[model samples]
Target chain A: MKGLVRTAVLLGVSTLVALDTYSAEPNARDIMEKNFFVSKVKSLKTDSTMVLINDKGQQRERKNTTLLKLQANGIDSKLLVKFSTPADIKGTGFLQVEHSDGEDDLWIYLPALKKSRRLVANNKKDSFVGTDFSYGDISLPKVDQYQHKRQRNEQIDGQDCYVIESIPINETVKTNSGYSKKITWARTDNFLETKVEYYDVSGRLLKTQRITQHRQVEPQPARWVALHREMTNHQTGHQTVLNFDKIEPGVAAPDEVFTTRYVERE
Target chain B: MRLRAAISFAALMGVSGAGQADDSRVPESPAFEGVQAFLQTRRVSGALRADYFHAAKRPDQGSDLLGVTAQIKTLPELGERIDGKLEARITNPALNRDGASQSRLLEGFVTLHLAQADLRIGKQIVAWGRADGINPTDNLTPRDYTVLLPFEDDQRFGTTAIKLDTYLSPQHTLTVFISPFFKPAMISLPTAGRTLRETTPARTLANSELGLKLDKIGEGLDGSISYFHGFSLLPDLRLLGSNPVEPILESHYDRINVLGADFARNFGRFAVRGEAAYVDTRDTAGDDPGIKNPYLFWIIGIDRTFFEEMNVNVQFFQRRVRRYHAPEGIADLQARAVALLNALIDGQRDRISNGISFRVSNKWFNNTLEAEVFAVLNLTRRDRFIRPLLTYAFTDHWKGTVGAEVYGGAADTQFGSLKPRRGVFAELRYGF
Candidate 1:
């Protein structure tokens, strides 16, 4: 009778622990898919300021306006960015068109040159116009490009969060992104990424990005936008902070706004 | 002499009209709302610049200038659909020293936005083609080669025209342009003792320039087909008397028609671009030694990025003369030299001449510093030219640029003939 009771207790405890584990850990791909859709609105327009601060406490500021619209099939997007301030770079613009199957198309217009030039999109690791945020950081990579694994659950700034570790799947992704691994901290309820840490090819910490001031821009479908983001490079002791002055989600825009000709307009 | 006067006019009018075309903006601070409000109606901005150049071969052949430029662009107010822009510049120790200070109008244009079309009328620049550094189909706007600017595009000046762009579809556009006046390129040659006179075509309806282009954008490929009918921007030299010591030459414009097509497509991380143009000139028989023969020019290029911020672009170009004739058979050495110079300058020295262009650029220090090198080599004549540039941004409003231009090969070759002009230059600019 004693032996049977002990065996029953062990079996019950094991089953409970297994059930708890199964429910506690979610699929990495599912989390990423939700995170990707969190900010994917029909269209968006925003005016923002980017501040670059160096190690010596010197700061340089740049103002820009961005317009983005979802393309056909609602998976890909096209984006246009125009510089508004910093007299030297004023009137410069960038146009990007995302593709579902292949590489994206990117073009830049320099007011000084009075011409637009198409550029290769492989420079994902390059600095984004002197900002600490790299081109890869500004662009959203496909969810399948990296292999993701669940880490642990923790509370960050009083909000429950889940940590996820992602590693590039191939040499191309690794080289293009210039990152060996990335660790992301996302909110549990909303699937909004709150923070991310990047590791260089040598597995050293390169940069850290912190996102805050999340606001729900759309109601029916539930969309949220981050009002501020700070990206810091650990090795260089440089940081870039982006603050959105005005953000309009689900706005309607004409398709012509994404064209190179329109982006080059004064 | 007429040649000396023509040279002076070209130096004064051509070189003075060269610079950048941009609507600079006043840097805004969020705290200064009052200033920002006033700037919205009429955006006024300007730049102060100082330039210095020195030639290695000839110490006295370079230029030094201090200049200030102002540009004003009016933003639409009260829901108006029209806007205007004007740019002007004043430089000291003008290329023509007849005046202590000289001023030139760079661009003054007004644009009207219609439902499906935009009409622009005034002095404006219309740059065409997808090629880098060299563009064969870009013949509408004339450039001053004598301008002592580091970038070749800076030598371009605005021309008066009426341009209309009609949007046929979201991905297609049709552009039409008409110009009442003719502008010829100012080319500097080694005319030590020659008496040359320039004669521009009369401003008549027949001599007007017209262009039409249909452009397709977006999706996988971007392409365009264009046609131009105008007096050639390049001049043909007519020898009045073939005097070996002091020949009297007359520069005259010829009527020509150009049909051009260009396309660009991206494959993975690499982009491929191709442009071709067939020029039909008056010298159809290819018998006139002083006139240029009909020919075809094409360029194929590929660009890709490696390691992050480094970019490499390589292009191969060819010029094929339809009816070929060699200028070596000319009896007079001076006439032969003149014909040969034209052939070399036009890249039609042979039935088919091939060339290659390479450009590499990289940025470092978070884009604070940038370095670029550009080179072009003629496979047939073995002539080459290389330009290396470095730029540093001191602040958001200040920039410094330093560069060198080098030419190589025999003197009779195209780039080789300009070896004497090879020099290093520097510019300091402050924009506000």
Candidate 2:
């Protein structure tokens, strides 16, 4: 009788322990989903300056205006980037429509050509206007497309963070993307990504991105915006610094702003 | 020259006067400060360029050209519908021993914006067609081939017209253009062997040109269909009188109607584009040797990028003449020679002519240095033209470029005939 009672007690404790472990540590996918929604907004407009530094430390600066808006009926978003400086590239524009279900659509307008041309959507690993940021880096990744795992809990810059390892779920995404895997450090308090390390196809560190500045934009949903970012490529010994001069959240952007006609307009 | 100088000075003074007027009229309130700042941001910007060319065989055709251009634009206040733009350019050729310098207004237009439509009226460049390098539907604006510039964009000349664009939806638009002035393309003639004269149509409403286009923009594809009722920019050559050594010809424009369509789409890492046009030269019977026969022109191209930076484009083009025939009637030996020359040069009587064009470009050093190569091969004529160029941005507003144009093939072919004109050129430009 005593052996039977001990077996019941042991089973009860084991069940409770399993439930506790599951509740205390959330899975990687859920954590990433939380991080993705932490700062999502209806619309945003930003004036930014991009500084590119070569291996020799020579620098070039480019200014741009960016607008982003979420679709009303779907999880997709639209983006427009217009270059405003460096006279040779002035009046250049890029428009993108990021779909939730599949690949994104992109178009580029060149002032010299005086026309807007549709660009292949699969070139996500290409540089964005000579900057270190690739097209994929500038766009938000679809959370479900990546397989994620919680690596550990650590502290970076004195803030507690959840270190997560993310790998592409399929060969298609892995082959097209510049990085084989990415390890992200997200703050526990706000779920803001503070740092990320990118690995190449050979599993070598290719780049490191750090967010140095953040500002709270909304109070109700607790939205935070990164005001400054720096990306350094390990293999090329090149760096790109992005400084946001102005950021406006919840701005009203009409659908026309995302159209190719608007991109072609002078 | 004096009148143009006066007009330029007056425009400068007008800008200063407008600035002063805005300063006095704007109030000190914070709300008005935004308006004042926006108005002050509207200013004239321009560029100054110097170009030099050297020909290996023809020193007389080489030239040193200097030019300056200025442009100004202003956006209307909120709730207002009127906006305006003004652009002007002046150029001087130092070595050509032709005429004096020239100045002209490039574009001066006023736009009226409505709820779903906009109308613009003045001298403007209406760029049509979607194909790169070669445009079969780009007939609204006339080009000046006599210009020493190598870029086709620089050779375009605007015409006085009224244009209207109506937004049918977010992805569709309808555009209409009406131009009262008929400006024919100006091609340089050989000064030694030919005496050339031109007869242009009289300025009248009957000579006006009309064009319409329907454009569609979508995620999967983008394209346009257009129709133009206008005169041919290239004139038809007619023999007036001739000697055994020299011939005198009258070049005159002819009425034409064109229907064109173009489309572009992207598939993963590749992009495809196609353009086609059918031209009706009014004389459909192919009986007149002086006038070109009706023809169908088409181009299909693809683009791809490799190695992260290199972009390559290839295109196949063809032209098919309807009711084709060879020239037979000739009254004089010189006239017969001229007719044969025209037939050979125009390639309009050929049953079917095909060609291929390819271009590759790459950039380095944060896009400061760019190199490009472009080639066009005439398969039917066994001729080819190649151009290679390198450009460097020295500063934020300064640029330098060096390039060479090369031609090769049979002596009677188009590119082969211009073999003597092949040369190297350099240019420097500063913008503000």
Candidate 3:
């Protein structure tokens, strides 16, 4: 009886130690999930400016207002974007409803046409409004769509980050996505993504995105927001920078604001 | 007219002054004030456009047209429940006889907003259609066929009317329109030693037009049903007096009723749209040789985007005339020719006519340059019209476009009848 008791105690202690070690270094999937949840807010509104720079270093700018709301069920999000600059594209609006279990819904309104049109949401690899960013790049990615693996721990720009590599888990997603794999560098303390590198299907470097100008909005929850982001295409020598001029977090946005009716309204 | 101009000028000055006051930190000077006032007004915006057209048949068969369009609107804050807009256009053509120089008011309207509805009064353009390029239900608006413009949108002409729009919900809306004035579509046809005159219905309450539309927007699909009771924009040709070589023809408007419905839906990578309209003419018995019979027109279309940016749209359209019969009781050869021409132009001879149209467009260089091809083929008549265009934006406010309109088939067919009008056009525009 003494021998049996001693063996049971030893097994329990070993199991506890192993769990502590495992918890210290969480898996890539858990880290990514944490990153997603930490970045999400109840609702947000922002005035943004997008600058597009070509190989010649010439730049063009576009101004827009964006609104986002997380559904009450917390499984869906609605986003509305209205462009106000460049004269020709003024009064253009886009509305999107992102779902976790099914396909997303997207609609676009052109003031010249004076009508709203529904767009295919599955073709997310297309460039968004002549910008370098694809629709998938602008949207929040589904965590289950990819298989994530921990690459290593590294310091980027004096900040400690956990580098994670994510690859598409299915052929459909792989074909639909412009990138085959993406490596993300997320800050260890706040889970804010600092940098991301995308790889083409040929395993070649395609683009790199860097986030900077972090601002904390809510002190209690320690919410950090990225006020500026820059994406550069390596093959094309084109770059796009997004600057959030104003951001209001936790704002109240009704569902009607995300509907097509509102998009079509001047 | 003087009162209207004064009011518009005052509104523009008020907006400009307010805008300047907001930027009071800048040092004040006469030159600076003048520049600032011109730049600050939100009420006025205008565009200057110049176009040149050349025909393939004659090297000298070309015209240069310069035009300016101005739009003015009341300030939003000052017009919480009352809003107004005025649009005016002036054009000068170098070699066109239709009009050497003309000035016209494109749109002028005042709107009163209510809790659940709004009312608009005066001359306005009320566009009603879901399909691209062609709309079977857009009968309220009149178009100018003689306009020397490359874009179809430029052909629209406003009509004096009163419109009431009621919003039932975010998904549904009801609209009613009343037009006390009658405007007929103008088509420029070669007289060929004949005299032609157009007569419109008298502007009276008895001849007023009425239209109603119920629209369902959003909810995964968009659709609308509409009804219009008014005079047909197309005119009917009547022989007033005739001789062996010189004939006199008068074009007169006919009363008609139309019921229309349109729907659009998206499925995965494809979008589908359908529109149908039933038109009833004044000839109920279908035996009158001078009036048209009832007809049904429909269009179905599909659109899709591929290769990231290329968009393609294809549509099939058909028009079926009810109780159709060829014209008879014509004794003179010239009269028979006139009757046949009238029958074809008025859609009175064909029992069934169909056509297919497609538009393919793509943009490059960050949307600075666009290339498009639009083609329509009349299956029954074996006639076709093709337009290929390229547009480039030199700057944010400056654009240039070049295109050609080509027609083919027998001269009696719809597109072929315009074969002599086939031409290539180039345009440059600046917007401010």
Candidate 4:
């Protein structure tokens, strides 16, 4: 009994220290409540083509595309990612991420050989179309899906930031994920999450996601400078870099675009 | 096998022209992974199970045993093609009021895959024939002579066999099998693998033999069909099955020919299935030996999904069976072989058993409350019986079924003894 108490105390103190160290703080939620604005947001759509460079400097390029539409009057958006190029995948719909938590549901669709499938949660760590970027890292995170606790203050690329530790309260929360906990760094000024590291159910580090080149002081008349995300799978040594190409504002698409008819309008 | 062979044939034929239709047509479980990717899961697990059986007649007597099984379902996930189920079962010897409990290592085997073909080594279930009632070609495993009938229970035996299964296409498969003579337990053995003086197991094969089979069929929602022929070693136990030192009589009943076919197709809400098989057994029958019994079986049922949310289902089933005459020479093989069987039967030389069973079930109330009724009627000369049963599935994995059977007919028929067979069974199962 005494040993149990001593162990519990040690765990509690260590957890507090770890949370303080990785907090990305200045507090991501507080920043979320502040700076970031989708004032004139439109349906964001893009064809993110990727090129892989081997150690020997050889390149294998793939035509991967992602589509997202902002929810009118809200910062949330519904997203779908598809890989369609290189002749190998002419019309393969790789994935579709939906937001359906309450009436608000979330989903990801995959079309490889003519059939499409729903990519569900417990899949946060699952590869995205054979890529390293987990489904959760690429898709939008639920507002406070986890209790965000600001741990420490840090600076990345000259931006003031708040490092926060997010822990899922109940097992029922669906992030299409299996993460026990995650440490995220968010810029306090812009409220944009800069970096995140995910841990497995066993509390072992599984992967890392780093967001770069925020629409910071855009020279172009774009609402967001197109956020860049790089996701790496530590176990497989595979990584995928995503670029949001076409960014528009003030266009909250109605239910029409989420339909199968428009998704495959071709 | 038929489906696999068809798949290959279709692939070759289609690629020569266009693309082949695939299993994508069959709604797959979100959990099912494709062949190439499926080969990557390396899973190992252990399980423990207990079975307790109580016979109504034996009030104070019952059978109970606890068993443990360890399975390695995956080989080195590296080769991208190691296949087959390999598991070992160990049951501890225990006291039983009804029967003796014995221990044995159940099964162990490995399967190797090459392209679309599969090769299996070690003891395995060499299941054969599509005939529902009679599977004459399924002989790789030894016959459990004590069962209601030979090969009646799929769990009884796993013989050392080598089989090759090749998929002709996504819809067709073909398999050939051979079981080099493996020893079968001589029931008369005073001890495991032992007799009065010398140990004698009823099995003999001076040479190895091969069997060929071909199947062309399938009806997923409905059923499947096939044609098969195999040389199975039938123990000639005229000697050991008799009194004292029958001196291990062992011989072979070679060159058995079987022509069989079976299928079931669902026309709307009604599902119909049937099997017709003829076995030209190559046993030299003597006067007292039994004849080769061929049979035909047919079943038709209608399952209408009246409600989805409630999962309410109602169905009706009907079955018809026809028995055939045994070969003239069957009555000739070592006389005792026939006498031993005749002693177990109280019927006339010419016998027939025909029956039909029907059941109806309704599932509702959060899938918790369920009601079911079943009835069976025996329709044959010198035989008559009736059985009624009920069942309820209280939960997803727990259910109870109880039934009572009444017999009325002369002692010469299955209705003999008027034993009034009845029992209640409760089972619990959980899946991961």
Say which prediction, candidate 2 or candidate 4, comes out ahead on TM-score.
Answer: 2
Better of 2 and 4 by lDDT: 2
Query: What is candidate 4's CA lDDT for residue B218?
Result: 24
Q: Where is model 3 chain B poorest over a 10-residue stretch in terms of lDDT?
A: B56-65
Docking class of 2: acceptable
Interface RMSD of 2: 7.3
- RMSD of model 2 against the true structure: 7.7
Model 1 accuracy (lDDT, Cα): 0.78
Top of the candidates by TM-score:
1
Interface Cα RMSD per model, in Å? 4.6, 7.3, 5.4, 20.4
- Candidate 4 residue-wise lDDT, B1-432, digit = tens: 334433433343333231111122234355643532343334332222222222222222322211112212222333556644544444321222224433433345666767566777777655543322233335445544322110123134566767776656533556666666463532221122323233333344534445555544322222234444444334322334544534333333334455555444434323344444444444434232333333233333333322221112222222221242332325545454333333223122244444554455554322234455444445554354443434333221223333444556654443443343333222121111
Tell me which of candidates 1 and 2 scores higher on DockQ: 1
lDDT of 4 at A119: 23
Q: Write the per-residue lDDT of candidate 2 for residues B24-133, one digit (tens) a residue.
A: 12334776556434544653345666554544223344433233333333323333777766666676643233435667676778888777788889888788776778
Q: Write the per-residue lDDT of candidate 1 for residues B383-429, one digit (tens) a residue.
A: 99999999876666566778998999898787888788776766666
Model 4 alpha-carbon drift over 4 Å, by segment: A1-266, B1-42, B45-47, B56-78, B92-101, B128-156, B182-211, B217-255, B283-353, B357-378, B381-432
Screening candidate 3 with a backbone cut-off below 3 angstroms (N, C-alpha, C), the clashing residue pairs are none
Error of 2 at B346 (Å): 4.4
Q: Candidate 1 on A1-266: residue-level lDDT in tens?
A: 99999999999999999999888767887888777778777789999999887786656778999998988876788899998776667788989888878778788898767777777676688778889887788877888999999898778778888888999999888888999999988898888889999999889999999999988887766777889999999999988999999998877988877987678776
B120-192, model 3: which lDDT tens digit per residue?
8988877787887788788887887777667776777789999998878756889999999988776765576
